[model samples]
Target: MTPAARHAAAIGILDRWLAGEAAEKALTNWARTNRYAGSGDRAAIRDIVFQSIRCRRSFAHLSGAETGRGLILGALRAAQTDPATVFTGDRFAPAPLTDAEFATETALPPAPSGNVALDCPDWLRPLLDRALGDQALAVLEALRHRAPVFLRVNSLRATVDQAVAALQAEGIDTRPAPLSPRALEVTGNARRVQTSAAFAAGLVELQDAASQAVVDLLPLTAGARVLDLCAGGGGKSLAMAARMSLQIFAHDIDAGRLSDLPARAGRAGAPLHLLDDAEGPERMAPFDLVLADAPCSGSGSWRRAPEAKWRLTAERLTQLCAIQDSILTRAAALVAPGGVLAYATCSLLEDENSDRIAAFLDRHPDWRCDLSRQFTPLDGADGFFAAILRRVD
Candidate 1:
């Protein structure tokens, strides 16, 4: 497709989104009906649509209107691309810009402030401010970009040097991430990662550097009984297994969320015992380590899903806090005396991170916080928090 045609396609998708249709659904429907678009064309169009959405307010202002045409023009201008060359009025290209459109290009809309400036909802500004302080804007700006692909070197299977060599053999380049000893940030051709021989041979698994650091902080030993209470997809569970020959028991309140664990475990050569809610008290036991990787607003992942920042509501955040609290309480009960309980979240909000841990410690006076740490997107990884607590008899 011509560059002009790509812009036209993006405008079409943006129009559907503006009409209240979901971004993914609109993009998918467009792709399905346009079989003439190749994989590269589809990916390019998708990037244009997502980039526009990520900076909707700013793009709307620059483009002079919030319509599809305006957004594409604004996005192109923001990227410093010459629209006249692309919108050349050629076959399959967008129409030439009118005198009115050209005249109005210089008269941009007012710059949004506070939440709107960040492309986030108004209700969330205060919370984000409280959580991030003077660095809030930097954090929000970081979200406007894409996240890097990180892989955790399965030390049990291969060393970092060995994994990097194997991955490089497949034309994949990587650099060591400073955040975690076991992490390697994919530098080039990251999209081919799933098909790389290194991945196929179980030498590496896709994981955030912050997530790997969180697991590395835990002191796991052979023969230890561990319970991953909120083990969604069992990423950490599998990582922990690779760290030691531990008797790992993974569980989630919603068992269906863990449906991929068996297959993922098989590929990683890690053994994990999956427990369903129906397993009941029969599986209840004092575990040496109990981990609750609770659900949250997913603030850490905004770089990958910019739409979530606009979709978050005050009420939804409050509900998430309550759920996190409950999970901490329930998961703590399964920790053996003298054992440790680890609580974690991907949220950058203090209320969802340290605050929840503080509340739990208040309720359980006998448990002491062993260690706690938080990371932000600017720190070279997704924002995350993890607190380790030891139960004292």
Candidate 2:
């Protein structure tokens, strides 16, 4: 498809998304219906749609409207391209810009201010500022662009050099990410990774560099018993398994999330046990380390899941904080006397990160936090917070 047609397609998908359909679902539905759209066309259209979402408010301000057409027009303007080129009224192309749209070209308002310019929700601005301090604006700006694709080399299977060579042979170029020794930021052909021998052989797995860094901080010992308390997809469990010879058990409130973990563990040659409520993870309790990678607003990952930023509400955030607190309290019980209870989230908000940890410490005065670290986009990784608390009594 021509570039113009791709923009037109993106406009349609964005409209569906604005109308309450999920971005991924809308894109998938479009793809299924438009079977003629090639892989390249689909990818290009997806990029356009996501980028527009990331900078939605600023784009709306620029185009003088909040509709899908306005967004595309704003995108073209941002890229210094004329909208007339894409909206040519040609077959399969977007219709010519309306008179009002033409007027918008000259009557664009002064740049958006404060939260709108930052593309951050107004209610979230204060929380973000509290969490990020002086770095808030910079981090918010970073979320307006695409995130880099990172791969974690399975050290148990292959050396970093071996993984790089294998991926390079398959046309996927990568370089070491400074955030973690095991991380490799993909430079090209990232889409081919799933089909590459390196991935099939479990030489590497797609994971955020900062997430890998969080796992790196775990104090793992040979034969240590580790419990991933909220092991959604078991990413941390698998990472820990690959790093050391440990008896790893993963448990989640919802067992369905672990459905693919067994296969993933097998591929990576990691020894992981899946525990359900019926089996009781507490039955194998007193774990040396328990990791609670709880859910959150996902503000740190807005660049990848831009729609989530717009979808979040104040009530939802409060509910998540309550859930995080409950998970911390319950998971702490499974930790042995003197074991480490690690809390982690992919959120940049202080209420979700530091504040949650403070609340946990307040409730359990016996546990003392030994270490805490926050990773942000400014550090070239997703915003993440990890704190290691050791039981003293």
Candidate 3:
């Protein structure tokens, strides 16, 4: 498809998103109906849509409206591209810009502060402030951009050197990430990675460096019984399995979320036992290590899923924190005497990360924090935080 047609396609999809449709679902539905769009076309359109979402507030201010066409025009303008070239009104192209649309002032819009200004939900600004303080603005600024793809070399299957050689042989250039020993940040050929020999051979798995670091923070011991209490898709579970020869047990409140984990574990040569919700506390409690990679507002992943930034609300955030607190309470019960419980989240909000940990510590005097660390996207990876706590009794 021509570049003009791509912009037009992105405009249509963005319209769906603006009209309350999810970004991924809308894009997938569009792809299914428009089989004429190639993989490159789909990816390009998705990128444009996400870019618009990431800078929605700024773009809306510049373009003078919140519609899809206005967003596309604003995004193009932000990139210093000539909208006239792309919105040529030719067949399959976006309509020509009206006089009012073209009459936008050259000066940038006045700064918005807190949530409206940051393009984040109002309720989340306070949490971000509490989490990062003066760095909150910088972090929010960094989130209004693209995320780099990082791969973790599953050493259980292939050594880092072996995986690097394999990926490099497939025309993908990657550099070792300082955050995690197993992580490699894809510097090039990310488009071809899915079909790369290294990926197909299970020598590498696409995981953020920070996420790898979170799993790395877990103090794993050989032959220990570990449970990933909220192991969605079991990414960390499999990573932990690769780190140590532990009897790994994976469980989630929604069992369907883990349906792909068995196949994924098989591919990565990870041995993981799946526990259903029906399993009683008596049977599953007393684990040496319990990892609660709990759900949250997903503030850390805003760069990748920009649409979620606009969808978050204060009430929703409160609900998520309550759920996280509940999960931690339940997960603590499963920790054996002298066992460690590792809590992790991809949220940058203090309420979800440090604040939740504070609450947990307050409620459970028997457990004490061992270590806590957080990684921000500005550090060239997705934001993540992990806190390891040990039971005294």
Candidate 4:
């Protein structure tokens, strides 16, 4: 498909998404109905749609409207490209820009100030400001772009150099990420990773560098028993399994989420067990380390799931904080005396990170938080927060 046609397709999909359809679901529905769009076309269109979502506010300001047409036209203008080129009114292309849209003033980049410039929701701005303080603006600005793809080299299977070489042989170039010794930031052919021999062989797994860094901070002892309390898809569970000779058990509230973990663990050749029953963790209690990678606003990884940024509400955030609190409590109960209860989230909000830890400490007077870290887009990966709380009693 021509670039113009792809933009037109993206505009349609974005409209569906803005109208409350989930982005991925909308993309999938579009692909199923529009079989004429090839794989490359679908991918290109998805990128455009996601990019528009990431900078929705800024683009809306530039185009003088918040509709899909406005967003695509504004994206073109932001990149210093004339909207007329893509909106040619040709067959399969977007309709020609109207007089209002073609105005020179609106064609300029969005104002470099306020929520529009930051692309942050107004309701959440004060929370981020209070949490991030002086660096709030810079971090918010950093989030208005794509996130880098990072792979965790499965040290259980291959060395960093070996993994890089294997991936390079399959046309996927990677360089070691500074965030973690086991992390490799994919430089090229990121899409081919799943099909590559290295991935199938479990030499590496797609994970964020900061996520890997969170695992890097784990004080894993040889032969220690670890439980990923909220092992959704088992990314953290696999990372922990590869870290050392640990007995890794994966569990999630929704067992459906752990369905893929067995195959993944097998491929990685890691000894990862699944506690399918809700009572399973309690039965296998007193683990040396328990990681509760609880659900949250997902603000840190918004670039990958931009629609979520606009969809999150303050009430929902409060609900997530309460859930995080519950997760910490449950995970703490399974930790061995003197064991580590690692609470983590892919959220930058203090309410979900530091505040949760504080609340946990307040609730459990015997537990003490010894280490904590928060990573933002400024850190070159998705924002993540990990706190190590030791069960002292």
Q: Which candidate is the best by lDDT?
A: 2
- Candidate 3 has which clashing residue pairs, if any? 112-117
The list of candidate 4 runs beyond 4 A from truth reads 103-112
TM-score (all chains, Cα) for each model: 0.92, 0.98, 0.96, 0.96
Instruction: Name model 1 segments beyond 4 Å from true.
Output: 18-22, 88-91, 95-100, 110-117, 280-282
**Per-residue lDDT of 360-386 in model 4, one digit per residue for the tens?**
989999989999999988889999999
Model 1: residue 329 alpha-carbon error in angstroms: 1.2
Off by over 4 Å in 2: none
Output the worst ten-in-a-row residue range by lDDT, candidate 3.
105-114
Q: In model 1, what is the error at residue 20, expressed in angstroms?
A: 4.7
Residue clash pairs of candidate 4:
none
Return the TM-score for candidate 2, rounded to 2 decimals. Answer: 0.98
- Candidate 4, residue 48: Cα displacement in angstroms equals 0.3
TM-score, candidate 1, is 0.92
How many angstroms is residue 392 displaced in model 3 relative to the true structure, after the best TM-score fit?
2.6
Q: List, residue by residue over 63-83, the lDDT tens digit for candidate 3.
A: 878989988887877777888
Question: Which wins on lDDT, candidate 3 or candidate 4?
Answer: 4
